[model samples]
Target: MKKLEIACFTIASIKIALENGANRIELCNQMEVGGTTPSHEMVTEAAKYDLLKYAMIRPRGGNFVYSTEEFESMKKSLLDLKEQAIDGFVFGLLTEDFQVDISKNKELIQLAHPLPCTFHRAFDQVIEVKQALEDCITCGFQNILTSGLKQTAIEGKEILQALIQQANNRITIMPGGGIRSSNIEELDRFVQANWYHSAAITDGSNTANAEEIQNLKQKLHA
Candidate 1:
């Protein structure tokens, strides 16, 4: 089935996306920094709903690589929200040289068991994306959020297409960064992916406007 994961930075945006037909959510905070862990209140409230929800587990957004302490914090956050209704958590980790941190990622995925896991846009920063994809698969990622290693999904659509073809249903290739109503229809025609991700933002406010979300759905349907 086709799906959309709205990256909502605020509770208001989450509601707007849900009301406007978003089926899944990537709950986060500090959109300016690529997003970070949401507040406990936000996670608690979001879990009360029956939607497919994933809380962003990023502690700080400078880079995907984490220090020992930072990794410990991510562990704590995941454990704290263990009993929530969240279907999964979105997270990523890489080494200094941009290789997949297979050991840590495997551990984290194991820790997030039962709740499926997603490797977020940190995928875009990897050096060997194809190998990394296989690594995530081995680590048991339910899906991966990426732009095919480009700055935006549109610019990366060619590589995204290749990645999708290579995946061949092993995992979902969710087009994310820089997605908008204006470009999504064209992107759909190009990528033909089953899943798409966006925040439905139409402005710098970083809020998911209901009208924008509706327009996005209509565009996909068209």
Candidate 2:
């Protein structure tokens, strides 16, 4: 059974996604810039839901690489959210050369301990996929949300399939980026992923579409 994870930016979006049977929410803000950490008020409000809510811990969105100060800021955000009902954390960091910051990511996984931690699409930034996957597993990240180093999941299906084989259940390789309800079934069958991700973006729209989410899940079961 393939599960759906939607990156929701608003309470309304969260409600729609959840009502439509999205298995989880990757909560964030500033989707135009990829995603930045959402406000405390937003997190507080979204945490009221019954579904699993994974807050984006990124302090900013330009790149995965961070300075010492930025790293500290990420930790601070995590600490602040620890007391909230937020279920888990999603974030990523890389070295100047696009290598996973093993030491820092280990710190991130540890800091978010006892809850699931996911290294986001920043996995696409890594030049060394095989080694980076091992690092993510070693660092205790529960999920790696990636597009298989491509701009979109459909474009990267071959690599996604290879990644799934390489992962072998050690860590979940969730195919995100440009996934839509219309194409999910095809990818679901070929990708063989138990987990899928999307923003539920519709034509001429930037906001999430509940109907699309419902349709996507329905297609998954079809």
Candidate 3:
């Protein structure tokens, strides 16, 4: 059966996602910057949930590239959380010219140790998407979250499909960005993904749409 996974950027939302039938979560902070490294407290807190949790490990927001200090911080954070019952870790590192920084990534991956590692949207910034996917695979990443180099997964479906074929089980290509209740069924059928990510929050002009999450799960599992 197809599975559904949601990305939760906060404590409240993490609980919501799990309660709403999310099988797994990608925990992060500063969703405004497309997710920065979550605090240690947040990671430890998420550990209490039964759902599998993967914490975002990016130190900052501007881009996927990392400085020496930033990389050091990432390593330290992962090491500190090593005792947590988290299922995995999500992160990525790239060169200034938009290439995977394999050596730097290897260090962080090593720190993550037994936990599965996911290459975040940093894959979107690589100069060559196919090469970048290959790089992540070679670096021993278990998955890649991407929108096929376009702004949203909806807009990038064609490229995403191609990427899925190219990945060919070497690594998981998870399509995220702008995924939602109304569109999830189409995406699930089209992408054949066992997992998907979305905010599914209720705020702004969204009160009437608050029930959309329940509807989404029904449709996804139908």
lDDT of each: 0.88, 0.89, 0.78
lDDT of each residue in 1-222, candidate 3, tens digit only: 655566676677666776777767788888778888777777878888898888888778898777788888888888876677778899999898999999988888888878999998878788888888888988889988888788888887888888888988878888887777778778777777656666676574211132655666787887
Q: Candidate 2: deviation at residue 100, Å?
A: 0.7
The C-alpha stretches of model 3 lying farther than 4 A from their native spots are 205-210
Ranked candidates (TM-score, high to low): 2, 1, 3
What candidate 1 gets wrong by more than 4 Å, as runs, is none
Better of 2 and 3 by TM-score: 2
TM-score of 3: 0.92
lDDT comparison, 1 vs 2, better candidate: 2
Question: Against the correct fold, how does model 2 do in TM-score?
Answer: 0.97
